[model samples]
Target: MRVLFASTRGSGHFHPLIPFIDACTARGDDVLVVAPPGLEASLAAREQPYRIGGEPPRDELTRVMKRVLELAPDEGVSLMTTEVFGRLGVAAMLPALEEVCRTWRPDLVLHEAYEFASVVAAERQGIAHARVAVSAARFSRSTDALLATVLEPYGPGITERLRTSPYLTRLPASLDPSPYAVTHRYHEPSRPGALPDRWGGSAEPLVYITLGTEAGAMPTATALYRAVLEAVSGLPVRILLTAGRGTDLRGLGPLPPHAHVEAWVPQADVLGSASLVVCHGGSGTVFGALAAGVPLVCVPLFADQPANARLVAGAGAGLAVTPTGGPADDSAVLGPDDVSRIRSAAELLLKDPSYRARAGRLADEMRATTPCRELIGTLDPHS
Candidate 1:
C-alpha cells in the first residue's frame, strides 16, 4: 500500500503518526508525509518521504487564530472548525494536497484528527482514509457544526469522516472522550540526544515542570510558571523546569535553589524518574506523566487544557488548578488564592499515595493497549 499522512505543523499533532509511518515502511509499503513547508526538514530527518501541503498565509492564519482563541468553549471549537480547518486548513492546502494525491495515487490517507482536509481530499479521490488522534476527542463535539458548514462541498460522508472514522488514539479508554477511537499504546518517539542529568536520580521527591511549546509561548502561561516557581521555591523536592523552545528562562522569574531550568528536555526521559509532574495540561504531557506513573498538577491555559485538567482531577490521578476568569481574560496575574491552590495541589501530589497508585493503574492500562504497529493491518485496502 502507498500510504500518505498529513498533519498540522505542531509536534504534538505530528508525533502520533510516526509509529504508523514507521510500521508501514518496515513492512515494505511505500509511505509519504504531507505537512506545511516548515515541517519538511523534520520529516526528512525522520527518513520519511514528504510533500508540502501549503498552509494559509502567515498573516491570515494569525488573524484567524486570534479570532478563534477569543471564542468561548463551544463557540471557540465551532470557530476553529469553520475558520482554522475550513478556511486556513482545507481551503489553503486542498489544491497542493490534492495534486499530490492525484500524482502519487496513495492507497490510504491518514491525517491528524482535526486536519479534516486530508479526509476531504481522500473522499474526493475515493481513497481509504483514517483519522489519527493525537489527543482525546477535544474537537469531536463541534465536528457536527463543522460538517454543517462544509455540507455542500463534502456532504454527509464528511461528517462520518469527522465523527466516526476508524482512528487511533494514545489515550486509554478511560481518558478518551470518544468511544469510537481505538486506543493505540503510547510510544515515545526517538529523540536525537541523551537525557539531561538535571534530576540526578535524587531520593528526594522529583517534580518535572513544562508548559509544552504552545502553552509556554502564552504571556499568561509565564505567570503560571512564576507561580509554580514560587510555590516550590524552598521545597525539599528536586525540580526540573523546562521553559520550552519558545520561552525565555530569564523572563520566568528567579529559579529556586532546588530547581534546574533548561530550554528543553526529553519529557519521556524525565517522567520516568519524576515523582510528580506539573504541566499546562497538554494531552502529551498528561498522558506522558500518567504513562510514567507520575501524578500531575495541571494549570490549564485554554482550548482542551481546562477539560484535560478536570479529567485528571476526576480520575483521581492528578489535580487541576485553573484561573477563575474566562479564556480571553489575562490570567497571568495570580491572586493569593490561586497561588495557594497551585501550591497545595503540588504539595498534595508529592505527599499523597492514592494519586500515585491511580497513576500507576492508568500506566498499566496504557501499556495493555494494542500497539500502533499491530493495529496498522487494519488500514490495508484489502482488509
Candidate 2:
C-alpha cells in the first residue's frame, strides 16, 4: 500500500518517523512525505523525495506568537494552539495535502501529531490516517478545543473523528499524559562509531549537554547555554556539550576546563554511557536520557519543553529549572540564580541513586512496549 507521511517544518516533527520509514521501506511498502519547502533537504539527506506544502505566513504567525508570549502559560498555550497550530498550520498545509492525497491516492496518512491538516485531508479523501506523537504524549491542554475550533469549517463530526482516530505513541503508559490506543517503543538510532577507549570505565562521571537543534536558534537558549557552561565549570564531573550548528560559539570565549564543546555529535552513541544529562527538555532528549538510565537537569526553553520537563520531574527522573523567571519567550536570561539550581540538581542526581533507579524502571517499561512494525501492521489494507 502507498502511505503518505505529513509533518511540520522541523526536525522534531520529521525525525520521529525515521525508524518507521525504514521499517516500512524494508517491508516493500511505498512511502512519500508531504512537508514544507525547507524539509526537502532533510528528506533528501535521508535518501527520500518529498512533496512541498505551502509555507505558513511567518510574519503573521510571529505576531500571534509574540502575543502568546505575554499571557499566562496556560492562556499562552491555548492561544498558540488556536492561532499557530490550528489556524496557520491548517491554512498552509491543507491545500497541498489535499492535492497530494488526491494525486497520490495513498491508502493511509501517517502524520506528526500537530499536523491536523493531514487528518482533515484524510477525512475529506476518505482514507485512513493516524497521528504520530512527537513526544511521550500530547502537551497542550487545548488540543480538543483547538481541533473543534479549526475543524468547525469542515462541518460536523470532524472533530470527533480526529479525537477518536488512531494515534502512534512512542511512550509507555507511565509517561504518557493521555491514554493511547496504540503504543510503539522508542529506539534511538545511531551510526556505527568507535567509542573512547576508557568510555564506560571512566572514573570521572560523564555529563552530556544538548538543547536540541531547534533550541540553538533561540535567544533564550543562548542564555541557558551560558548558564549551563558556568554551572558545570570547575565541577569534578567531565562534560561533553553538543551545541547545534545554529549556535554561534565564537563570542562565548574559552570553555571551562571540565567541559568540551562540539557543534554536533551522535547523541545515541554518547548517551549510552552518560552519567547525567543537562538539556532543554525536548521529548527526544528526555526520553533518550531516561532510556539510558541517566538522570536529568531540564531547563525548558519553549513550546512543549516546560511540560516535558515537568513530566520528568514528576516522574522523579529529573529536576526542572525555570530560569526564565516567567515565560520562556520572554527576554529573561538564565542568571546566577539558575546556576545554583543547575549545580545542585546535577550534584544530587550524581550522588543519589533513586533518580537513576527510576530512570531504569522507565527504561524497562519502554523496552517492553510494542515495536512500530507491529503497530504499522495494523494499518495494512489487506489485513
Candidate 3:
C-alpha cells in the first residue's frame, strides 16, 4: 500500500505524523510525506519519502489568513466552530496540494485535520483518506463545547453545514497519534537523554520548561521564562529551559547555578526524567508529560492549548496560569499574579503525593487507549 501523508509546516504539526509514517513503512507499505519545502529535509532525514509543495515563505502567513476568511463563515458554523478556522487554515494550502496530487497519486491520503487542501484533493480524486488529530484535547468533548460557543454567532445552519460539508463528513475517520500509549509509560529516558550540558548530576527537583515549538516564538517567551525563573529561583528544583529555535535567549543571560537554558532538547528525553513539566500545553507536550506520569504546570498560548490545559488540570494531572485581565479562557500569558499562582501550584504538586498518583493513573489510561499503529492496522486491514 502507498500512503500519502499531508500536514502543516511546523514541528508540532509534523512530529506526531512521524510515528504513523514509520509504522506504515515498517509494515512494508510506502509512505510519501507532502509538506512545505522547509519540512522536506527533516522528513527525508527520518528516511521517509517526501515531496515539497506550498507557497513561498513570504506569502505563507497571508495565504493562511485568506484561507481562514474563506472557510470561517461557512464551515465555521459547527458547534466546535474554532475548527472552522483551523480547517480553513488548512484549506489555504490548496494550491500546493493540487500540484502534489497531480504528480504523485497514492492509494490513500492520511492527513492532519488542519490540512484542508490535501483532503480536498484526495476527495476530488476519489481516494481514501483519514484525518489525524495531533492533540488529545482536539477530539475531546471539552473542545467540542468550547468551539461550539465560539461559533454560536453563526446560528443553527452551521451545524447542518458541518455534517454535510465536504471537509468533515467525507473523511473515513479522525485519529489522535501520540506514541505514549499509556500515562505510566511517560517517563525519563534511560541514557544519554536530551538534557542540556549544565543539568548533569543536578540534585534539585527537575522542572522541565518549554513552550511548544511554534508558539514558543511569541513575545510571551521571555516573560514566561522570567516568571518561571523568579518563581523557582530560590526553590530546590533545577530548571531546564528549551527556549526553542529563533527565540532570543540573550535576554535570559547569566542563569543561576540551579537553572540552565538551551535552544532545544528532545522533549521526550527531558519529560521522561522531569519531576514536573512546565509547558505551553501543546497536545504533544501535554500528552508526553501525562504519559510520563509527571504533573504539569500549563501556560497555554493559543488555539486548543488552553482547553488541553483545562482538561489536564481538571483531571488532577496539572495546574494552569494565565496573565490577569486576559480573557478568562486565555491561559497563555504569565503576569505577576499568575507567576505567584503557578509557583504555589507547582510547590503543592511537588510536595503532594496525590498529584503524582493521579498523574500516574491518567498515564495508564492514555496507554490503554488505542495506539496509532493499531488504528492504522484497523484502517488498512490488507496492509
Q: Identify the candidate with maximal lDDT.
A: 2
The true-versus-predicted C-alpha distance at residue 307 of model 2, in Å, is: 1.9
Worst 10 residues of 2 by lDDT: 183-192
lDDT per residue for candidate 2 within 267-292, as digits (tens), equals 77788768899998987788778766
- Model 3 Cα shift for residue 88 (angstroms): 6.8
Q: Which segments of model 3 are wrong by more than 4 Å?
A: 56-92, 137-200, 325-333, 381-383
Candidate numbers sorted by lDDT from highest down: 2, 1, 3
Q: What TM-score number comes out for model 1?
A: 0.90
Off by over 4 Å in 2: 138-142, 180-202, 324-331
Tell me which of candidates 2 and 3 scores higher on TM-score. Answer: 2
> Over the full model, what C-alpha lDDT does candidate 2 score relative to the true structure?
0.77
Clashes of each: 0, 0, 15
TM-score pick, better of 1 and 3: 1
Across 226-336, the per-residue lDDT of candidate 1 in tens digits comes to 877777666789988888777767787667667888888777778877889888888788877887778998987666777788878989999998855424455445565
The parts of candidate 1 lying over 4 Å away from their true place are: 142-144, 181-195, 199-201, 325-333
What lDDT does each candidate get?
Answer: 0.76, 0.77, 0.64
Tell me the TM-score of each prediction against the true structure. Answer: 0.90, 0.91, 0.77
